[model samples]
Target: MSGKPKLYYFYGRGSMESIRWLLAAAGVEFEEEILETREQYEELLRDGALMFQQVPMVEIDGMKLSQTKAILQYIAAKYNLYGKDLKERALIDMYVGGTTDLMEIIMSYPFIQPEQKEGHLNTILLKAKNRYFPVYEKILRDHGEKYLVGNRFTWADVQLLEAILMVEEKCADILTNFPLLKVFQTRISDIPRIKAFLQPGSQRKPVPDEKYVQTVRTVLQMY
Candidate 1:
């Protein structure tokens, strides 16, 4: 809260969206530095804060932080959103890892060549439901809780919600076969601050690109 928290990322919703989500969830105030061109991003590399030469970097409390997940956990720990106990924190990490795996696929769609982008998007949609969503669905079923870990909201829920939103963007009806996930997604969407961040006119892309996504109304049909 001392120095203005600064975030660096390209415009639109990319890897940095989740970082924004965590900040909003924590009710923290931060400044944004949108990297608009390759030159700008390259220039940022000169600072050495971005060790990986990637974005979604942030600076807070006089420390330059890179790596999306690490920054997210840092904010979570700062806001007491990490979790209540040791085991819950571990489970939170597990779900966040799974969510990241699925998000990586959805995020790759735009960079793909036009001819291959459709197939890439379809694969992402399939993998999101087939390979990842079920784990959380089962966790929700077994735990009978509104949030992903423990009985309260945690950084894991924010991560999972972002993943689901990312996949839903690619496949609008992808969750039809997974009602539990749909509910889980809704629960997070209604969070007051998150709701405001997601309102109409927001910069978030509804999909990676309209041309690449296919309308998969039923998840079972992914096979």
Candidate 2:
């Protein structure tokens, strides 16, 4: 709590990206320990820093946290971004849960086989248009609020903004049908903290390229 939270993950965005987004949205500046080699990760294992031997471990508030959901929930709660009540928190959880499912697909794209990359991209765009985007679009249409939950900028909004950008990276016009989401994306991106994070020289990671993929695979010892 005294010092800035320290994150342990690869140089590129993966499960750790959402954590970065949440912290940024909360206006919390943190440090990162990038794992560029297998030995660095194994050292964490050796020192018992990783709870489940995962890379997205965060050392914060005198605890070493792993598991993406747990870490996200803690940060959201601590930063007062979860919700004011249980019902609102439930909605945030639901919205974030759905968004996480969509992000997971994108996160795995780098490791996918070259032959299947086209099909994988098709799947991503398909789900974004048919399944995922519609859900948030409907929520915004019905809620008539600036954010998904409680009309306040919470973890759900941060996650959605991150997802929207990730999807748009694949297809620039993915939000053409979802006008509300396009507005939401622009509005959220303009928020002071998020706006700062969006600018150059922030902790935001770039889209995973071949070098990033190779580095991750090498560090994880994954063929």
Candidate 3:
């Protein structure tokens, strides 16, 4: 109980996961305000002066902040998690920028029609994956190491892992064909901090006992 700030997180378990994972990796302490119902969320919206209009808002000493990447930037800056050199920090920013595009695609999948699934949704992912894989491979190849950017873990590493996991979880078929992508995913997961974070309870909520994700898998299987 170090009296760290409180973070108000919503239930979707999307972009918020990256912020949570980065905090965990930094060993930061924060209270979680999980709003489970619309009534609760409405209450938050009305009764609070600085409350977030969206989920995944973090409050440091009662000051509210929103936007997942901005929260990561603030935490990374405060916790000294960015990097030592300017160029390295720039690289981390580059990776985070790339990850934002990946997140957009993931969020768009649910809106895609059945007929458009393979053509519209999967096609974008396939292209994005192909484009990003070599960049990651070059990083791993050039650094002669794991972890993106620097000697220590940064937000870039977390963002990269989250992007890779989203693809695997949502569209493993697209990933499996790319051996380098699979290897990159495996390599990132092997990081000790990341490996621990990927364990069962690390998810924002308890995943259903059954394979709820199977529905998405089945739909993808149809293509």
Candidate 4:
């Protein structure tokens, strides 16, 4: 309905990166609208214009979609990123769900108090190291695939990379323990379209803000 598909979100990656990456990988032409402030966000939330009480809204092909996973899946389906078959789809779902778990922990950092933030972040990292990271590590190690689910690239790889980069950016040595997983990260990140989406002049921030950097520092135990 609109002149071109448009993605709406804050400046940071937040929950929008996967969708943005998907669009780029699929070579979809789209416009991006960045909501500049909390007040503006609150207004949108209060006005009931948002189907869900959140950002990362996407308008495309005469439909507006909310919820990150739903949007990712829709884009994946449209672009054939969900994997090649039912079995691959199941595997992708498993990784996507796990990545969502990891995201929940990282997303909590901004709301954490400054004094307690470091400890909270460290706890979340430990949670990842114990609960989340190894699952994917084993997948990459055992499956021996450059991508996550199938022989080809998929949305699962996109989701997994977004999650892994959450930790890798902060702790330079975190991925050292999981060599295959590290390679997987590089392989997906190197995808030409996703690579371009992450280039310096891209609309997204090149790095997380200081608050999130504090979380990364805590996860890496650098502070």
Return the top candidate by TM-score.
Answer: 2
TM-scores vs. true structure, each candidate: 0.85, 0.98, 0.77, 0.84
Rank order (by lDDT, best first):
2, 1, 4, 3
Candidate 2 TM-score, C-alpha based:
0.98
Model number with the top lDDT = 2
Give a tens-digit lDDT track for model 4, residues 45-120. 7766579676678987677788888888888888898888899888888889989888777766665678998898
Question: What is the lDDT for 131 in model 1?
Answer: 86
Q: Write candidate 1's Cα lDDT for 1-223 as tens digits.
A: 4486898865556677788878878778778876555566657777676878666779987888888888888899889999888898898888888888777776766666789988898799878778898788899999798988778989998888888777776778989888999998888999987787788865444554433222121111222
What is the C-alpha local distance difference test score of each model?
0.77, 0.94, 0.67, 0.75
lDDT preference between candidates 1 and 2, better one: 2
For 1-223, candidate 2 gives per-residue lDDT tens digits of: 5599999998889999999999999999899999988889889999999888777999999999999999999999999999999999999999999999999999999889999999999999999999999999999999799999898989999999999999999999999999999999999999999999999999999999998899888988878
Higher-scoring candidate on lDDT, 3 or 4: 4
Candidate 4 versus the native: TM-score? 0.84
Per-candidate clashes come to 0, 0, 0, 0
lDDT for 111 (candidate 1): 60
lDDT of 3 at 216: 29
Clashing pairs in 1: none
